[model samples]
Target: MPHTLFIADLHLSAGRPDITAAFLRFMAEEAPKADALYVLGDLFEFSIGDDEQSPLNRRVASAFRDCGVPVFFIHGNRDFMVGRRFAREAGLTLLPEHQVIDLYGEPTLIMHGDTLCTDDAGYQRYRRITRLGWLQWLFLRLPLKKRLGIADGIRGKSAEAKQDKSITIMDVNQGEVARQMRKAGVRRLIHGHTHRPAIHRFDLHGQPVQRIVLGDWYTQGSVLVVTPETETLQGLSLGENR
Candidate 1:
């Protein structure tokens, strides 16, 4: 059956060779079989800039290009600093932060899913400030080493912040989800950020709706396979499903 694939939050880094190997395996073994692949967000642990394409980035780009599948990406919080140079190299198109698309006859909304966490005001504030064009312009002008240092510092602080927050506060707010669905006019929404993998079904304005959350690749791979006939959420084991 013809189908599309959705994945996100791989958080791939040179330090995490296991996840990188799993992703490469996936690109070689699974992604090529799909009609199209949508990478919703956070493909990298941190991206200082597209110009600073480390060996890992080059390898990932080669993998994506060699996979021979139409690939699309949405900016995640961690990779928002990434630019089009790598996208071109990877043979992938960059979509808007949130997009509505025709999903096998149904309208589906896709996003990186960070903005839905209305409760995390601090993170939301950080996102807003970091996404500013002028700020990014200045940041990108710095030396690559400086940029890397800044990125590392920010990543460390973010990890510290996460440890202080409760899980529920970090997750998506139901009201925000509903609002986004209504605004997008979609009955189905797919996103990945919080690393909670589940298909949530609920009533929206007396109609059935689904919010699909994709998991992170911290331990194993997560895939959301969708065809005209069915939607399946499966875990692609990295020899460590436990």
Candidate 2:
């Protein structure tokens, strides 16, 4: 079984106990069944803790470490500070922003899609500063308590930023999507950031392609499963049947 997986927007935080349980269950059951797992972005609510010994982080990482498959992670706005330490501890491969790979014999591109928010100049500018190497280094050097405080402050600020942004500015622009699709020479674009889960079929240069938006895993469970024999995108809620 060739399984190329995609999940995003977990936003796992110490505040959400049920989500933590569900995620643990996922690793214990669901993850093992897959040949590979691609966590699109936002695996944590905000992880800047210096303690590699944190119980929560270690527990989550251990699940993947024992899953017996490849686990790939991409950085999202919330958990962008996830560093090499976490990756090494969790036994995950950190994927770059624009990663082109072959899955199931088809060319595919994976991203967090924050760059697609070209219309949101303010947010884009913020992304630039946070991603800066010097800024990250300075931020990480702070004490664990201070880092946690900073993470909390940033989270609150992000909520404010979202409130001020327009819907169109936040979502991916169609033209930009088309341009990237053409450039990558792959019709498939899979990402998760806007928390809108849908499988979009579009015609580009007379060729049909798919743009998959992965949903947030909070009250509902969603995953995009792509394999040679089975390819389907669906949402799973508590009351819904599988």
Q: Each candidate's root-mean-square deviation in Å?
A: 1.8, 2.6
Encode model 1's per-residue lDDT on 1-242: one tens digit a residue: 89999999999998888888889899999999999999998999998888986899998999999999899999999999777999999989999999998889999999999999999999999999999999999999999999989989998999999999999999999999999999999899999999999999999999999999999998889999999989999998777311
lDDT of 2 by residue, 101-170 (tens): 7887888988988888788898889989988999888887888888878777988988998898889899
Top candidate on TM-score is: 1
Per-candidate TM-score against the hidden true structure: 0.97, 0.93
Q: How far is candidate 2 from the true structure (C-alpha RMSD, Å)?
A: 2.6
Q: CA shift at 66, candidate 2, in angstroms?
A: 0.6
Question: Model 1, residue 43: what's the lDDT?
Answer: 97
